[model samples]
Target: MLDANIKQQLKTYLQMLRHPIELVASLDNSAKGRDMEALVLEIAECSDKVTVKLDGDHAVRPSFAVAKAGEAGRVRFAGLPMGHEFTSLLLALLHVGGHPPKVAPEVIEQIKGLKAPAQGGHFETVISLSCHNCPDVVQAFNTIAALNPAFSHVMIDGGMFQSLVEERKVMAVPAVFDQAGELFGSGRMLLEEIVARLDTNAAEKDAEKLNAKGEFDVLIVGGGPAGAAAAVYAARKGVKTGVLTERFGGQVLDTLSIENFISVKETEGPKLVAHLEEHVKTYDVDIMNLQKANALARTDDGKLAVTLENGAKLTSKTVILSTGARWREMNVPGEAEYRNKGVAYCPHCDGPLYKGKRVAVIGGGNSGVEAAIDLAGIVSHVTLFEFDSKLRADAVLQNKLNSLPNVKVILNALTTEVTGDGTKVNGLVYRDRTTDETHTVELEGIFVQIGLLPNTDWLKGTVALSPRGEVEVDAHGKTSLDGVFAAGDCTTAPYKQIIIAMGEGSKAALAAFDHLIRH
Candidate 1:
């Protein structure tokens, strides 16, 4: 049943509905099947422009297709659309009704380039109905399919296809696979990643021509908040600025909520990223999304040269490093396989997706405790597992976690494996130290918040790195290298907050601008 508030919202959003649309529900006539039909009918009642039709197709049971009247829809949801996926359903309806896409121009171009005389490929994204991150990945793939007829896609609900989940060893949501049955990736993937997966050679060839010989006054490596900020500042100074990022938003996109951004009372990671991307677009910064900096070197002319993974070389007078940090995995069995499906590192990104589902937090430190506290409000229950005998979090954080009625803390419990059904997380196995007994807890998700790992593997011998691998920088964001600066979580900044990263990025840009003027 639809909530009163949500019903009103849908009415307002669907007022622009053009051309009658049909929601074809394929059912098995089971209890769940009847409920699915009712849900579709309820949605149809929201507006006269939409209608529900039933088909007793057991193969596509619990699935629904949204298409214009008298047409077979290309967009199909092979499972229930609930939780965060509800918004995705709403957005799809809007898109089908002449609402223009919000995909980046470069991404659209890539999709167009993939077009061929014959069908090129197919991408299937496996998702859970509650997964908030699943919608973005689904929408991204849908956008590609809509743009180019050469490709096609379907959003498969992991819960509905248990056999396929088991075959793929799916442990997370938003897992993408190709027509060849090869797993492309899991988690919240960028559009560029999908494009690259579609045509690796073409992606490389395209990167080769992306200003391989052009010189810039300032080139920022990494696409997090810091790098984005630095690029904006340098570009505003009228310098030839460029940004190389594997993905824009960095770890910030993994973050779920933000209340400490200073001026703003509250915001989410994706919203902040949208603002950041919009801000970056306001400038002439040459943003090379999905580009990775492979190696760094000094040219004969005393300029900095950054070699990309695609073999393209970008030479610049100054370079700013804003490569951010990543989550440290538990490295246990099923951890990697289940990533994003049921095992998540970013609680903020995936927590709400697990609403009313039991989840486990591996670790009893500050991050683990904080995650447990956050999940308590959104999930049915939270279980904290610590390898050590006692929690390492501060007294205040521990007190806060203790206040949560649905949270359980298990100390000296070593996680042995992340066990799950073929489709989603179902339980966790751990070993109790004192009793030497193994225990299994039934849960739907696991959030690993043990530690943060800096993205500086490529900079091993190129720069002065701290023992922890963070780039060492000074007050002015200067590194050991004369013409190189670093900022954000990748640098040895005292803090790793978004606002701190942005400030450091501004400092690095100002320093780079100063170097150009004084040199």
Candidate 2:
């Protein structure tokens, strides 16, 4: 059922359709199958060039192929497409209908040059329709398939495919898997990173080639706001600067809304991430995306030798660890089992998908309280649970939470289990420590807003670490190591805000540049 406004928009968007696009739906007589057929037919009715063909012989009840008329489908989407994925579906239609690829030229060339395995590779991108970052990952893989015929890509809705999500242990969205390995971590990643992930041999070779250029003047080890800021600053100095990151944007991509980023009144995590990447790309910094620093050591020549997970090594004169933090999990039963199914971490990323639904926010801290207030505006009702006797959030945040009519707060409640029907989350079970009474709250989703753990586990023993495992750094973002620096949430920075991280990253870059000048 397409709304009038949306149908009109689609009709306008499809007005310039150069060629016919086909939706080859593989469906049986099941409910999901019938729904899939209806969805495909609805999409086709929007444009004269679009058509739907039903194939009932497939083993899978609800799978589909999207391609041009009389052409074999190169892209397939399994499971229902809704929420954020609806945007992905519309974009896919535009692409397959003869629109040009929006990817960079070098990226297109690299993807085109990718050679599939002898038997061909079947790439699967596990995504939650609600994830803001998931669409880009899907678009990148689909574009790659469009550019190169050697490979094909399928997009699976993580929420609908609960068994597959569990089997993959998908804690986050955009979890890609292929014969090669997990391309990047479970989050938003640069498109080049996705391409590099699918072809590690080529990536390793690229890393080797880059390293052969001798030591860099400054090497930033993370791709968050701070690392990106540092990269921009250092590269502007006309020095050989390189940045190594598992993925760009770091925790920023996990965030949903930003009202205090300075200057901007409001923005989303992914938009800011795009700005960060765009700003970094304006410089000549050698960005090694999808690369993690496995180990760090000082070379005999007074340079830093950074080993990657793929066994590649890069040498730099100065290094900055801006590795960010990840959301803390509850570790309760069914929490991990029903991650995307009903248990979510980033309220900003997944909140819209649960609009008008009952949800719970775990934790009484500022993050949890803030999430409750935020979700109250989108969802029908929000239940806030805190293990402490009272809320630990700032008085202002507590006041905001108290003012929300759709939110209910529970103190001294210990979450025991995330109740689900082996498919999606349905309710949450907890116990009141004060009365020793158990309570089960019926809700479709639960948002865990505990705290964040620093991403410095890989740097253990190499750099000075605090008692809490955060990287110990000086005021100038300098680590105990003479030529190394650290910043952002991974460091000893008192604040973990986006603006603070950007400032810290800039400081770290300047410190590294100063060290280079001194030596």
RMSD of each: 4.2, 5.2
- Candidate 1: worst-modelled 10 consecutive residues by lDDT: 114-123
Candidate 2 local Cα displacement, residue 60, angstroms = 7.9
Which residue segments of model 2 deviate by more than 4 Å?
Answer: 1-65, 76-83, 97-100, 104-110, 113-129, 150-197, 200-203, 331-343, 348-360, 373-383, 394-400, 403-408, 413-446
Query: Candidate 1 on 1-519: residue-level lDDT in tens?
Result: 688888889999898776787888888757777778878888898999998889734355677877767866667777777776787788777766556577778667877787432234677888877555678898877766656656666788876677777678665667888777877777888767777767647666766677554899999999999998998899999999999998999887766668899999999787899899899989988888888888999999999999888778899999999999998888889887666668888675556567778999998988899999988998999999999999999999999999889999999998999887766778899999999999999999999988888999999989999999999999999999989999999989987889999999999999999999999
lDDT of 2 by residue, 64-103 (tens): 8888788788788887777777777777788778876777
Backbone clashes in candidate 1 total 8
Cα misplacement distance, residue 25 of candidate 1 (Å): 1.9
In candidate 1, residue 30 scores what lDDT? Answer: 75
TM-score of every candidate relative to the true structure: 0.84, 0.77
